[model samples]
Target: ELGLPLEVAVLGVLESGYDARAMSHKGAGGVWQIMPGTAGHYKLRITDKLDERKDLVKSTRAALLFLRELSKQFNGDWDLVLAAYNGGPNYLRKMLDQHKKKTFWEVSQVPGFKSETLEFVPRFHALLHIMKNPGEYLFKIPEMEQAEVFDVVRFSENISFDLLSKYAGIPLEMMEELNPHLKENEALAQVNFYLPKKFGNLVLKKIRKYYAKLRLEKYRKKTLRVVRYRVRKNDTLLGISKKFNVPRGRIKRYNRLRSAHYLRIGQILKIPIYRSVKSRGRVAKKYRRALSRKGAYRVKTGDTLSRIALRHGTTVARLKKVNRLKSSFVKAGVLLTIPSTAKFQPYRVARGDTLTGLARMFGVSVRAIMRANKLRSRHELAAGKTLLIPDQGS
Candidate 1:
């Protein structure tokens, strides 16, 4: 019955305060503080170009889907849902069983969890109270007779948000407020634009008119139908499939992968969710930013998969292929792409390596290096490789 997106946002505000970059300092980052491993479960790209976790809109969608499952596990109690959302469902399940309290109220009294989770219920109730009749809490949103969220559509190329604001006659500041699914200033750079149900069609028309270069596209939003699996000492695809009511073939397909030997500790997989809502998008030429695929990556010295994927929003697998890598084995200065962006630090000039040689080694132009690094002097190479080698960061 609680199908309203607004109601979901209300809980997210309590979970992450609606900040996409909210990280837990427990190595958690993004509005949801989604750990890298857990995020990988949803196939949320850890690539360099874009951090989907920092993407408020994408992350919120993921969070909502996650909450739906938690609700079922906790038997529809918002209190238990909150606890599970914060502490994870399995942790709560174990505690609930140990406490002998049939309901969330019973589990709240159980010992040994973070204090934030312990205090979650009362806070949620108070917040919900304030939301239903905001006068009590002084929270006011301009009334919109009903709460129907916008439909997200993809664009072909990056467009400035300012242009959209000018067209909509709405303040640029209010764009994200209206569409909580976008990154800050993402409307213009966004290949995907979300518009209110009634208003989306109108906005699409206007966008096509002014931006003739925009092409129509089909878009899909990422969902949160991720599986909850803890890395075992030695679990394989078949092992996990047997544990979670999923088929091995289905898991391989979503991951765009073929190998079962590569999984490591803390690796969580997003089992194909048979019963979750799908995110659909129509593409326009103007929304040209391409979505990345997942892949494997080996660690190189002075290398981090996160940094590699950050530049491209790409995962690690594809990074290796772009670099023509044969295996995960890597040494210092081994260049590899994680899974995300296509940008990376180029090979820096070494003590004896000439700039021209370095460029030739990486199949790039010396002039490009000069321009890329803003180098004015031809003799400015530092003894320890001064050139920044590039990689198609995941």
Candidate 2:
């Protein structure tokens, strides 16, 4: 650790109350309230997926190093250093030159200095004093509990915090609390994951077991394939579903479409196709049995005979003939018999499947699979993880 005044630690209290995720209106982030430019200067990563300014250890070290540099610049003047840290060093130096002041106390009386910067140093000192002498301040602090120890585990591949928590038997909330800097559900590769000290070995063992299972399942299991299709002029969801021999609901789900009427021409949709593998026959049998049991569907609002027929893989004529309907219209809460068709299937991802590759192989778009799974990126696809495949033709 860089040797500096013990009082410097209290700056975090004044800055953000030690909240790693604390952000200012000025776009400063983390416990130290580092600005974006400062974070960039310190080489902290800031991306849509990652913002290292919220990383406790990294941000603290950067802040301390920054304080050290400021100390040297102000010639060991802690007051000036604190002032410069609040306002920019260049601004503080400019104020000093204009007012011909040698110390922060002298500069404080000048009108040109920012009020926030002028008050920052004093507020820090006040908090430091109050913390030092709580009895004098009438503050009855509760007895502190022994801090929970943590062990860091480094990963070379991307994995979800959900999986890690499950594997380690740690609560997901606790994991998120411990690692607040992880912005997404999936932790990126080459990052440190902190686990409770007692669960470190257990997490490692479970993760290894998961990887081993993935390797074994790669050659032994059949997975769902994805296909992508672009909407054509005047294309409708029902028409597109019929063309692909997939259900309309599945199309909406895969593409994250909120309504059937919102389709735009040239919009690409992901279509999940069930590939014919040698192992698929057994799965098909089980799937058929399950589908047979689902024989009735209750009519809902906006239900049309054609739409229901398209969803159930039947024709309007077949539905009308079977149900003995006099009209094409149906009311909500009416039960109709449905002939069984293919439903969504769950497929565990294997070692070699890339999102793009899966899209290509199944004739679906990468965006479709991502939308269906609610995945932030393709990187979330890990081996031994199950994905729901939208059913194609029976």
lDDT tens per residue, model 1, 1-394: 4362356556666757866656676766666667677777776665534566765666656666777777777667777787787777888888877766777777776666667777876787777777789776666857767665666666656555687777755467656655433454655344456665666677667778776433211111232334334345688888766554456876765664668666654344555433332222222111111111233344556765546656556655755554545674557643232333434454535456666765654445777767777889778878755455453221
TM for every model, in the order presented, reads: 0.40, 0.55
Each prediction's whole-model lDDT (CA): 0.59, 0.76
Best by TM-score: 2
Residue-wise C-alpha lDDT for candidate 2, range 190-229, written one tens digit per residue: 7766777777778878888888677545622433544345
What TM-score does candidate 2 reach? 0.55
* TM match of model 1 to true structure: 0.40
Cα shift from native, residue 114, model 1 (Å): 2.0
Candidate number with greatest lDDT: 2
